[model samples]
Structures are given as structure tokens and as C-alpha cells.
Target: MFQTDSENDSAEPHYLRLRNQIANEIEAGILSSGARLPSERKYHELIGSARGTVREALSQLEAEGLIYRKDRSGWYVSPKPVTYDPTRWSGFMTYVAEQGRLPATETLQVKTEKQPPAILDIFGKGVRNPLYRVERRRSIDERPVLVEDITINPALAPGLARHNLNGSLSGVLRDVYGLVVTRNHVEMRACALVRHTAECLGVKSGTPGLLVIRTSYDARGRVIEYDQEYWCANAIRIEVDLTVA
Candidate 1:
């Protein structure tokens, strides 16, 4: 029943402007899961547009899985994207909690190690960093969300498990290792889940997931963690939120 159009960007066409306005509300978490969207008549009033224009916007949203319309009951908001908040300092647990979902971790392996060459390139340095291999699966409300293989330089966080592998690595590094993360570089691409990865993540080998390659550095600009996260493809739509100074 609320207005959708804004005077901020008046140059755009009325229907397109309305569509974007409604879409942003869905993305921002203000309009929550299962909340029925206003009727066409209501949206027409809200956007100061024609009924046909409002219907076009609604149709687009429905096609994109952002909302759905019942035969007679009208439109309702889609579920929130599987929450993967970039603003958070913590990992899956903190993010899940913020979204009101319970989180659990499956720790498959944690072992001291030397640097791996492929990972060395990711860190952009020599492979002599003295590292450990940490493999785990993170789940949201008992549903698998991510499978992570982290190569952490022991020099950064001595006896990393002494802090906690089940929760925030960023916090542990800062609290125990006295290191602050100043940089993070992420690269995402699509790949088929391998048998090993899929088995750990409860998906099939052919299942598509996002392979996220990441390098994290301390405030001193030292590479600390070189990791790959296999996120369930259906779990989230990662977006960059940026602002100009």
C-alpha cells in the first residue's frame, strides 16, 4: 500500500522506475518473505502510473522469482535470498544469525602444512608461509550453504584452532594474532561440484555452485588466508554494494 516511485531519479520512464523501486525493496530486506505485495490498483496509486504499467512491473518481478501472484489472492514477496551478507565480519554463523537462521559447521579436516603452489599464487607470494589446511562445511538451519577449503598461514594465527574454527576467523586473527584484515580480494565463477566437494556439501557432482577464490591480508598487508569457498548456487545471489565518496 506504500508508494514506490521516487523523485530522486525522475528522468527514467515511469514503469521502469517503478520496477526498479519495487525490486530494491525486495533486495533490501524491508519487504520480507511471504509478505503480500500490494495489488495492481494499489501499485498504480503508489507509483502514480497506469494499471497496465504496474502490471508490467509485477510480471517482471514474478518472472525473476522475486515475487509470485496467486490466482486470486494477488502477489506476495519471495523469500529473502539465502542470506550471505558481505557487511559482516564473521563467517556463516554470524550471517545466519543475522538472518534468524541457526547455523552449524562440519569440520572434516584441520592439519598443519606447508604452502601449496597453486595457493601460493593466490596469496601472491612464496609458498613458504607455513600453513594449515582447514576443510569444513557450513550449513544454515541445517541446510548446507558453503564448503570451504582454507589455507591459513600459521605465522598469522598460531594454533588457529585454539581460538575457534567453528566461528569467525577474522575475529580470531584480530583478537589472538593481533592482526587486522585490511584487504580482501574475491573472484567468483561457476563450476560443477566435484564428487568430493558435492559429497561434503550434500549436492550432486553435476550440481552447479559458485567457486569463490579469496585472498585476505592483514593490516600490515600480509597475506594471511588463501581460500576457496564452494557456495550452493541456489543459496545466494552475491552483489556488490558500493557508494561514491
Candidate 2:
């Protein structure tokens, strides 16, 4: 059984004391990343607190990005976040490998979709274009990180649907269609994961996450692709380097 410091016993809530203890152990590397934690029942027994108190402490740790709960699997220490540079054109696989982490992608669904009104606005009003919709989930070190829904202008890359999408679509565009991304417009916002995406990432629905919307354009300024990505909040860190004029 664990005991709180006598000085803290009177000053802090039981759950806060538990949270601080675990957080300190994690920061001190006593609890290594990816290590599964003791069950709530076990923790409460060890700490001499209610199971609900232990659960609340775990929830706090998760919100602070120090831990995660894998459905059916118990809590685990969160891995160090992957740094992502929104300004860089380097693809996901390349960057992830550069950081000495394994990157993986799974193509979930691929279909030819009629231009929805929002899509038509981007492709051009009243343009009857065939858009390819692709759904994918990406992981690092076998832990699911993000899910993306992509819209591709098949007219820009003929036979795009025929190609395997389990890899980088940017590579497919460059190698197969001879098109390279020259410009991108990116927007980010905090969101709650919807049901489908939440399931894909192995998180509960309505879990807090980050949404990244990207529209890629070629040198001639045509919108080739638009994708929306829902990222596990603790799994990634955004970094951008800029040059001063």
C-alpha cells in the first residue's frame, strides 16, 4: 500500500494526491512509456482509496497527456509525441522514420463519390466531377494515432483509385500522375472525436482531439486533394520552423 506525504494529506484531495504520485513516477521514468498501469482496483487497494478516486486520478492523467486508456486494455503511459511540422512538405512515413519510430497506415475504405455540395465548391461550382473518397488510419509503433478522410480529384490523377492507398498518397501522385504538391492550406481546431473516427483510433466517442484540415494544390494551382484528419490529442506535437526575411 502507498501512503501520501503527511504534509500533503491535509492540503490536497485524495485523487489529487494519487495523481501527483503517479505523475511524478512517470516523469521520473519509474513508469516507462507504453507500460501498462495497475488496474483501478489494484491502484485503489494500493493507495487505500476508493476505486472511483483512482479512476478520477487516471482520467486527470490522461487529460494531461501523460497516459491513455486502450479500450479493453488498461491504462498505459503515453509515448513521447511525434513532432509534426505543418509547413514541411515531407510525408508522414518519412518524418516518422527520421524520428526513429515506425509508421504504419491502413486503408479503411475507398469509393468513388458524387461531388457533394461542399466538394463542388472546391472543385468548381456546377462541375460534375467524380471524387474519390478514401479513409485511412495511421499508427506509430503499433499504437493508433490518427484517422483521415480524404477527397481526391480523380480527374487530376487518372486511375488514382486503382492504386494502393495504404502508403502515402503524395507519393502516388508524384510517381504515378507526375504531380507534386506545391502548396497547402492547413487549418487546425480542437474537437470531439465522432463515433466512426473514435472507433478507428480505439478511443471513446466524444474524446477530445485535434482536427487538421488540409487542401493540397499543384504548381498550376489546382486543388488536387482535401483531407480532414482527427488526431489523438496526446499522440502528436506540432512544430514549425520559419526563416526570417
Candidate 3:
């Protein structure tokens, strides 16, 4: 591992030193997601600091969702940070392309996995029952921007493979399936990027990332699509448009 500044030997709290060093590594992309940090003792020796100091720093980082401890394992870097916009009703590809970057999808994994238990519990269905899933790394101006895992009603849009994914799913839903999207119900929260997300987005595990839960509705107010997008912090920003009545 490429080590940076070690903790100062002064009586300053040891955890602060650890926090500063780890934070620096994350911002620099040196200690990316899934990057395992040295053990507490290792950190102590590496920084010529006390074990308690290293422990304190690790604790704070974990609490902030910057690092996590594994069973029989150690701490690791989180994935890319995520940014979300609660104001925009447009879909992911549409919102991103409007920013002037061409949209693309690599289709890393698209088969189907059991819907997360919480999701299944809420929807009360097979959960994974025939969801049209498409996972991709979203980018802007050729710079990595976000990773999107979108799931839609396969019954609504049966022939997903025939659609041109380079553009927006909403467009396809409108033009091909004739299911016009008019609105969406959305929510936002803070979370840490786990192993998979961290590896793909090039951040660390337990790193702070945005969590978006949205249900897109069509002209008939029917929930046709649901999506989760893990966006890098600096990749994009959302601004609300206002009008004076």
C-alpha cells in the first residue's frame, strides 16, 4: 500500500490522525473502495501511534460510513460517493443526457437476482419476478459519473432487448411501448458503498454514498419503473427551478 503522512507523535488524539490520513487517501483515489486498510496494530505501528488512537479513528470512519470492519477480516475503502436530486422528475438517462453527455450502457449484469428482502416485503410479489434489469456504469463527458441498477415491469415492456439502450428508457417506454412517463415518486438517503459498488465505482467500502429510491409512473399514474442509482459525489449536481406565482 502507498502510505501517506503518518500520525504525529504528539499527544493529539490518535483517531484524528487516522481519520485525516484515510480521508486524504479517499479523496485522492489512492485507497479506493474495497481497499483494505491495515489492521489496528498495523496502523499503530505504521503511524508510530498508539493502538487506541488507531481504534478511535477507525470507529469514527465507520460511523461516518467511510470504512467498515469485516468478520475475520479488516477495514476496507468504500465505493464512489453518490449525489442525488429530489426535485427532478425525469428518469436517469434523460436527466444525465440533458447535461450534454451522450448516454451509454455496458450491461454488466442483467439477468435477475432475488429482489432485496425489504423490497420484496414492500411490493409483496416474487420480488425478482421478471424484472427488466439493466446495470450500467453511467458517465458524463467520458468521465465516470454513476452506476445505475434499474428494474422495470417486464410485463409492461416485454421486448427490452429490441430497444436502443443508448438513449433513455423513458423514451423507449413512450415511443415503443407507448407507456408515457409523466411523474415519479422518489426518496433519498445516505449510505455506504458496499463491496460490489465500491469496486465498480472505484471508491471504498463504507464510504459515504447517496441512496435513491424512486418509483416512476406513467401517464395513467401506474408505477411502471423503479430504480436505484449510485452516483459519485462530484459527478453531478441538482438544482431546483422556481417560478413566481
lDDT of 1: 0.74
lDDT of 2 by residue, 54-160 (tens): 99999999888899888788999999889989988778899998999999999999888886687778866435667888999999999899999998877778777
Give the per-residue lDDT of model 1 (tens digit) for 92-111.
66766877877787777888
Q: Write the per-residue lDDT of candidate 3 for residues 1-245, one digit (tens) a residue.
A: 42434524566565675687788888788888669987888877777666777788888887666766667688877544333356765655665566555555555666554566665453445435646677777665554556778876667788776666756767777788888767777776666678888788776666667666677777666666777887654444445567898
Using lDDT as the measure, which candidate wins? 2
lDDT of 2: 0.86
User: Residue 63 of candidate 3: its Cα lDDT?
Assistant: 66
Which is the leading candidate under TM-score?
2
- Return the clash pairs for model 1, or none: none
Q: lDDT score, residue 191, model 2?
A: 89
lDDT of 2 at 111: 87
lDDT of each: 0.74, 0.86, 0.67
Q: Which 10 consecutive positions of candidate 2 have the poorest summed lDDT?
A: 1-10
Indicate the residue-level lDDT of 17 in model 2: 86
For each candidate, give its TM-score against the true structure. Answer: 0.62, 0.83, 0.57
Error of 1 at 77 (Å): 14
TM-score for candidate 1 = 0.62
lDDT-superior candidate, 1 or 3: 1
Q: Rank the candidates by lDDT, best first.
A: 2, 1, 3
